[model samples]
Target: MQDNSPAQPAVDLRGVVKRFGTMTAVDHLDLTIRSGEFFTMLGASGCGKTTTLRLIAGFELPTEGQILISGQDVSDIPAYQRPVHTVFQSYALFPHLTILDNVAFPLRVRRLPRAEQRARAMAALEMVQMGRYGDRKPSQLSGGQQQRVALARALVNEPTVLLLDEPLGALDLKLRKEMQLELKDMQRRLGITFVFVTHDQEEALTLSDRIALMQGGRIVQLDTPANLYNAPQSLYAAEFIGETNLIPARMVSADHGSSVVEALGQTYRAEGTTASAGAAVTLALRPERVRREPAGTGPVGELVEIDFIGTDLRLTYRMADGSKVIVRQQNSGGIPPAIGERMPLGFETDSLRIFTS
Candidate 1:
């Protein structure tokens, strides 16, 4: 007879809490990263994303709770003993060592034969497209090249999981974006669980299969990139993930799927929340989701300002009630709207997200 069970998570944090002297870094957090998935812990500085990554890497023990790696509880294990490797923002390569030697350093410490070490190190370097630079010193490589070497070092050990703590943070904007694509592609090829931490929202959305948007040492929302952007559960999630136009509103009627909201002296049926009728709420509207209409087709507003941002035009309008609405439309080589021109704006009901204040 055979019994079946689901595969264990690549990393699991069960009610994990980390506290410093008079300060709580990671609150009671429970999270599970699926095997071979690109998981990102994203938040601003001091939000415990780094601390959480440290805990998973066994750099810091949890004050309370357990951490499991590949179905084994390793909450108390030392960093070197865990089946995981970390790539830090600084790269931490030895300046004196050759690129191949730097990657082989881990194997050397484990007493692996020099031949095996070199073979494994070269293979890892090839995986990151840095094999040809094996003989160069760290100082001789560009920032992006050094980053790839660091990643190669981390991968040389063939760890069950890889933890990246903003590895691309040190690169310039253009190189950072280039590395973002490389990192995602590499992760896909390796099929190793990557636990990435970053404060950059765009980077997180770009590389992560799922993201945990953390605040105050706790996860505020955990979902795929698209879901986090399109269906943010709260205002913070909305404003943090992308630009949103927040408008003051009140719930006229609340239903399961849709609700009637009154805002800018007009009524609209939009996505609903748990808020009851007569509840004061906020409407989150994405600028690109808004539609500009004929002068009197919908609520009319005076275009106060227009900005040409490369591929898009940002238009700001002041409604009759003195509320401002911003719209972003693609620049299709058409005439621009003049300032002070009154035009009606319309948006689909489902595009508006209603959240109780």
Candidate 2:
């Protein structure tokens, strides 16, 4: 049969669902990944992120709904038959084969001519900056080199989409950071769709053009890194994307898109208006936004401890009501307050996010 799938939207999942016995792993999920875009699925373990990736790779069939690549349904298609490739976290290279052979294995399986396979393998190796190591066995290379070889093997197929499942999870911190940049660069140069799965929020924010935050088998939020960090839509999203301080507050009054909240026995004007009145709410504030001021100007608190974090300082203060609040200050110039010193903590009204609990 001639393949008549649309040559766009590298991947599209419509009402995708997967179940294991009585528990549903992926619940009625719908997603669309644009062609040539670097997309990421981020979530904790057992949140169905990997299951979604597996379903797209055809490693696991969905119980219901359709998986479309380029607009053609491939829900029941086997992994080997699909024009997709996966680079796993564990660099699954053949230890006995040379790097060149490992990269050429896929082409050989398709029975390509020897000359064509050799040329393609060398090119793939060069693309991953491993041309000189093509003659070396996978056992002889370092972890980073082996990972590059794995990536080269996946790229050699010239597949429509490349799925990476924590491909940098094995490398050291420095190497992982370097690889993140390299992978993004390679994706841009190749113009191929990349669906990356990672639980690290920093990695996702740094690498992906957009991220889908998964929670309990569903997508809680999907947006760019800046949007996800600056304006999270829910409590879970705010807490997950980065470090945040959640302060319990109550909406006392609101006017002209601004509301006043009573938090920690102090009334402060917040930026946004909420629908519910007399409701318990939480204000999401970043530690860096909380500023230290003179004791007489703002909320009074006693500095309990100061933590030196090399480039910054974290100050913990205890309010009269016995609530602990953390403030992160840059270590550029000003000397931090001594322990047991009294100070006023002031935060901008615009920085406060009022959300219903």
Candidate 3:
């Protein structure tokens, strides 16, 4: 008989909750990370992203619920017994040891043969492109190089899953971007499940196959980067992922997949809604989705301010009610509307996301 069932998730958190004295860090979170998937936990500081990572790492035990790895109940297991390794923001390498010895430290502690340790450690270094620096001391390498060595050390044991706790946060911006590409490539090539934690939304969008955006100790939204950005289910999800214009609106009517909302003294057809007729709602419109139309063609506003952002122009418009709406257009080297000039704004039907206030 052929087994057609889905494989077990590399890591799973079932009804997980973590409390710190009077505060709850993770509030009954149920999450499953599939094998070889790049899953990211994303949120601001104190949003429980890091706390969730620690719970999975066994550094912090959950106050309630079960933690599983490879379909096994590991809620009671200690960190050393878990089939996972964590790479922290700070590359915790021993300065006294050479790169090779640092990578071999884990195998050494496991009491593998000296030759086997050396061979495995060297292979791990090569995997991260730091093989040539095997003999160099940690102090002799640059920050990026040191981070690569640290990654090699973590990977040397070949754990089923790799937990990265903002491992690229310590690097400079340019280097961090470079490492992001490399990390994604490495994950794909090695086919290892990566459970990454980061507060940086851009980083999460760039590196994750799926992201869980957490807020107040719960996942506000969990989806692919594009869906999280384009089809945000809540105001928090829309506002957190990128720049958005929150227009005060009132729901006019609603159906299964669409809704009509009134905003800026005009009616608009918006994507899915959770509000009923005449209820107060909010419209989340991304700046880039806004179109500039001739004055009086659509919802009219006066251009109030303009800023030249590289590759794009950020324009602020003042509605009659004095509320401001921001619009972003690509820099095509054309003359922009003068400040104080009146212009109409256009929105595609799919661009407006309506949420109940």
Give one clash count per candidate, in the order shown.
0, 0, 0
Worst 10 residues of 1 by lDDT: 1-10
Candidate 3: where are CA atoms >4 Å away? 1-6
Look at candidate 2 and give me any clashing residue pairs.
none
What stretches of model 2 exceed 4 Å from their correct place? 1-7, 254-257, 271-275
Instruction: Flag the better candidate by TM-score, 2 or 3.
Output: 3
Q: What tens-digit string does per-residue lDDT give for candidate 3 at 1-357?
A: 112325888899999999999999999999988888899999999999999999999999999999999999999999998999989888889989999999999999899999999999999999889999999999999999999998999889998999999999889999999999999999989888999999999999999999999998999998999999999999899989989999899989886677888898899888866677999999999999888888545788899899999899999999887888899999999897799988898876688999888
Error of 3 at 270 (Å): 1.0
lDDT of 2 by residue, 1-357 (tens): 112434478899999999999999999999988888899999999889999999999999999999999878999899999989999889899989999999999999999999999999999999889999988998899999999999999999899999999899989999999999999999999988899999999999999888999999999998988888887878888889888888888888765567888888788887654746667888888888898888546677899999999899999999777877789999986776799988888877667888788
Task: Give each model a TM-score.
Answer: 0.95, 0.92, 0.95
Evaluate model 1: give its TM-score. Answer: 0.95
Tens digits of per-residue lDDT for model 1, 1-357? 001224778899999999998799999999989888899999999999999999999989999999999999998899989999999899989999999999999999999998999999999999889989999999999988999999999999888999999999999999999999998998889888899999999999999999999999999999999999999998999999978988889999988778888898789888847588888999988999888988445788899999999899999999898888999999999899999998989976678999877
lDDT over C-alpha atoms for residue 31 of model 3: 96
